[model samples]
Target: MPNIEYIITAEFHIDKGPSLVFQYPHQLPGLQNLYFLPELMLPDQIHKRNEDYTLFLLYRNLNTGEFQYLYNKNNCEPDPYFLYTIVLNLTNDEYKRGSQVKSLSILTNLSFFKNFKPVMMICLDLYFKSNDHHIIKQLYKSINEKSFIISRDSLNGMEINDISLIKKLLITSILDLPINDKIYYDENFRNKILGIGKSQIINPDLFIRKDLSFNSILNFNEMNIPIRIPMINLPDTIGDYLNPTDLNFKPNLINILNSKLSSSILNNELTIYGLQTPPIIILINAILTGKKILVMSYENSSGYIIDHILLILKIITGGGILSGLLTRYNIFPIIDVSKIELLEECDSFIAGTINPFFKNNDKLWDLLYDLDLNEFIISSNIETPGDNIIKSSIISEDARFLSNLQLSIFNYNDDLTTIQLIFRRHINEIIRILLSSKNFNNNLLPNNKDLILLLEGIGYYWSSDTTKLLEISCYQLISKKFQNLLYNEKLIYNLILPNLSNELNLMIDLHYHLQSLNNVSITTKINEREIWFNILKFLISGKSLEIFLLITYLIPPNSSTSLQSSIAHNGNITIFDKNKGIELLLINLFNFDDQIKSNIIMILQELEDNFLCGWCINLFLKNNLIYEIAFNELINT
Candidate 1:
C-alpha cells in the first residue's frame, strides 16, 4: 500500500459529514477516508481548509526518519480537487511555478491498498528536443539545490540523504543530455529506448563527448536527413512581402494536412510522415491569412488525374516524369554509390531535392511566425520540388539510418502523388523554419522526425521535443484538419465525387478513403462503410463477388482460422453477400472487454435492435471469440 494518512482536506460538503475510510497509503481516497500515507502528500493547511478535505500523506525526512507535515495540497490551487490531472513540470516542485510548465506526477489516494503499504513514484514526462543538455544541467542543479537522493523502499519508506552522499544520483536523463552526449543516433540505444528499457549508466566522460557528429542529410549520422523545409515551402512564404498585404498562394495546402480539421475523421494515421503539417495552413493564401488557411486543390478527378499525370509525363519537359511506378515501394533508401542498387529498384525520378532554407539559427522560425513568406519576392521557382528524388529513390524502413552512410540529396519519404504536393506547397516555409534550428545545420541529420513520431507514440517523456511541446501541438489539430479535408467541397466535388471509374480507380479511391476512414467521424462512418460496400458490389455480381472475396480472402472464413481474420472481417459490409448489414451491426456490438481480445458477448445479446440480435449470434460463431470484457473470469479445468 502507498499511504493513506489524513492531514487536512476540507471543502464543499458531500454527505454533510465524512469521507470514506482509507485503509492503506496507496489506496484510492474517497469520501471520509483517513489515509495514513499517500503517494501524493498534500500540505496539511490546504487539506484541512474548513471542508476542503482530500486524501492525506506524510513525508518523512530521509536522514532522520522523522515525519513532516506533508498533507494533501491537491485541494489548494484553482482546481484543487482536480490536482491529479494537472500537468506539472518534472522538477521536484509539485506546486505551481508557471502556466507553461507541464508536469507529470500522479498521486493516488490510499483506499485500494488494503493492508500493504502502497508504493508511489514521482512521474517524469520527457519530450525530445535537441537542446536538452541545458535543460538537464538546470535540472541537475535543481536536484542539487532542492531535493535530495533517497533509497526507495517498500519495506520502510523513502530514506533521504544528500544526493552527493548517494554517489550516483540515479536521476534518469536520456532526453535531457546535451546533443553531443545524447545517444539518439545510436541505433542500438535508440532501439532500447524505443522499447522503453532502462538505459545504461551514462558515462560522465561520454556524456560530454565532443567527438560525435549530427548530420542533417543522413550522409554520416544514425538518423534520416530532413529535406530542408525552406526548400519545400519556400523561404518567403512566411516572410513579409513587398506590400505585406498581397500574395497569390491561395489558402494553400489545406486538405493535404492531417484529416482532423473537419472533426469528420479521416485516416487514423496522423503524423504519419512525422512532419506536423496542419490542415488549416494548406489553404487559400494561408501564408497571407494571419491565423487560418483552408486550401485543398480541386484540380482534377483521381481517374482523370492519373491519366493526365501519365499524359503530362509522356511529354516530359526534358526530365524524367513522375509516376507511382517510380515511387511505388515503402522503403525510401539513402542515396549513394553503395545504395545505387536500392535506388535502381525504386526507379524514382528523385532529383535536385534541397532544403532551400538552410541556416543554423532560430531566426527563420521566428521570422515565419512574425512575417509572411508567400508575400515576399523570389527570383526563380524552386527546382521543381524533388528533382533530386528523380535522381534518387529507395523505400526502406531504415532509410533514415541507411541514408546516414550515403550522401543522398533526396528522400522518398513521400509517395509520388503526395511528395510533389508537399514540396510544391510547403517546401519554402519548412526550409525557413528549419534553417533557424541548430539541429538543422549540424553535422547530424535533423532526426526530429524520429523524435516527433516517438513522442506521438509514448506521449510525453522526461522532457519533450521542442516543436512538439508547444501550447497547442500539431496532434491537437489532426482531427479537425482531417474533417475539413473531407468536407472540402472542391476535393469531394472533383476528385472523389464524380463516381466515374473502373474497378481499379474505385479500388484506389476506396483505399484512400479507407486510409482516411480510420479517423472518420461518427457522422460519416455509416456512409463511408456504405460507400466501401457500394464500391465492392460494383466489383462483380453476387456469385462473382463471393468468388472474388474468396480469392482475395477479403472475406475470411472465421476468426478461429486466425486472429487477424477477425480484425479483417471487422467492417463486413461486403455486398453481393447475405446478411451484410447484420454482420456490420454485430461488429458494432462486438467489443473487446480486455480490449486486446475477448469481445463481451452479453452486450450483443442484450441489444434491443433486431439487426444487432441476429448478427450477434453469427459473429460469435464466426470469431469463436467470447466477451471477456469486464465480465466474471473463472474456469474449471
Candidate 2:
C-alpha cells in the first residue's frame, strides 16, 4: 500500500486573467500529482457584475479510519462526507475596503479513496445584489473518477510516478463536466475551449437529413479539362516514325526518341555490321507500334544479341517511353532452343544463337524448320539455314522509312560494311546538322562528351592502319566543331589537348589548326602558355618520363615568359610586377607529395639555364618546397 498527503488550495481574484489559481501544499508522497486549470474565457454575464460568488467544494470519500479490518478484507462500503465550501463576497465591506476576503480551506482524511469512484466535484453560483440577475452563473463539474494514486507497493517498495496518466485522467474529467448551456453555446467560450468557431463545427444530423451529393455541390459536367501542350514542335520527318495508334503517346516520349535518333544518325552511319543492327530507335518504334519482331543468332553470338534485346526491354519496362504498357503485349526473347515450346506463345521471337546441338540433330532442326520463317529474324552474322534464306523483314513501317532514308543518303554497299566507312561517307552532313541543331545552340546536347569521345575512338581504331583516311577524317571533323565549342581556355587545355592525340606532332598540328582559323585569334604567346600548362597537367596526371622529356624538349624557352605576358594582360598588370603564375604554382606545389615534388625539382633543374628557370628557382627559394632544402644541400656539395 502507498500513502499520499495533499493540502490542495485554490484562489479566485476578480481582476486576474486566470481568475483562479490552484496550489498543493504537501508533495504527493509517492504518486505523481497533476493539477488542471482549463483557463476558459468566462461569459460576459460573469464579468459584468460586481457581485458575491460562492463555490461549494464537494468531496465524496468513504471513511475507512475505524474500518481498517473491513478495508483489508474489502468487505464493507465506506460512508461519504462533505469536505468544505469556499465563498467570495465582493460586496462585503472588507472586500470593498480592498481586504480581498476570498479564501477556502479544506482538510480531510481520504484513506478509503479507490479507483473508478467519484472523489470530488465543484459547484459554482453567482449572486447579484439586485433581484433582476439572481444566480447569474451556475456550474456543477465532476473531478476525475480515477484516484490520484498511480500504483501500489512492489516487492522493492519503489514507487514510479506516472505524471502523464494523471494528466490524461484530469483532462478527461474537465471535458466531461457539464458547463452551463449559456457558456457552452457562447462563441467565445466554445472557441477558447474547442479551438474552433461555432460556424466551423459540422453538424452530422443536419447533413444526414438533407439530400446532398458531389454533383449537387460541384457542377462536374460543366467543368473544362485543360489540354496538355508540347514543349517543342517535332519535325514531320521524325514525326512520321511515331505510332499513330498509340493513344498514350506523349510529347516527352517523342522528344526523347527524336533526340536519340538524331544523335545516332549524326554519330554513326547505317551499316550491316553495325553494333546495333536495325538501330535502337527502330526497335523502340517497333514496340510502340505493336509490331512483331523475330531475332535469331548462333549460341556464340547470342550474348551480344541478347544485350541489345535486354537494353530495349529495359527501356520499355523502366517507363522511359510507354509507361510499361508495352509489357502487356506478347513479347519474348528466346535464348535457349530447348525452350522452343514457349516460342509458340510469343507474337514476336528474338531468337538468339541456335544451340550447337541442333546443327547436326535432325529432330531439333526439324522443329526449328517448323518455326514460321516470316516470324523469325536471323542475325546478320549467321548464315541462313535453308536454301531459301529467311531474310529479316522490317516489322515497323516507320523503321523501314528511317532505314531507307539512311541507305539513300549513305549509298549502302558491300564495301561500306564497316561503321567507319558509313560514318566517313556521311561525316560532312552529320557535322552540318549537329552544328545547327537546337541542342548545339543551347549547349544542351545530352551526349556531347560522348560525341567528342567517339572522335578519339575513331582515331585509335585506325592508328595502325596503312590508310590514315579514317583517322584524318575524325580529326578534321572534331577539330572543326571543337574550334567553335572550346570557348573556355581551361576546357581546351584540360580536356581537348590530351584527347586530341598522344603524338607530339598531332597535338602541335591541332594547336596550329586552331590558330590558323580565320575567326580565331590564338596569339603565339597565348598558344605557348596553353602548351606549357597542358604539359604540366599531363606530367601531374602521372604520364611516363618519356612523354615528359619529349614535352620538355618541345616547349620553347620563352614559354614561361609567354605565360607571364598572358597573365599580365588578363589581370591588366605589368609582366615585370610580382609573378602571380609562380605564386599559384608554388601554392600547388605544396599539395604534392615528396616524390612528385622531387620530380618537379628535377624538371626545373633541366630548365635552370633558361630565363624562365630563374623565376621558378626564385619561387622555390622564396617558398619552402621541402624538396627545395634537399636540392640546395646537393647543389652546395
The most accurate candidate by lDDT is 2
lDDT of 1 by residue, 505-613 (tens): 3222222232233334554333443434443433432222222221121111111122223335563312212222223323433333333112223223333222212
Clash number for every model? Answer: 158, 4
Worst 10-residue stretch by lDDT in candidate 2? 207-216
lDDT by residue for model 2 over 292-350, one digit each (tens)?
A: 34443342232233333433443332211122222223223333443455444543332
lDDT of each: 0.22, 0.27
TM-score of 1: 0.16
- How much does each candidate deviate from the true structure in C-alpha RMSD? 28.4, 37.5
In order of appearance, the predictions have TM-scores of 0.16, 0.16
Q: What is the lDDT of candidate 2?
A: 0.27
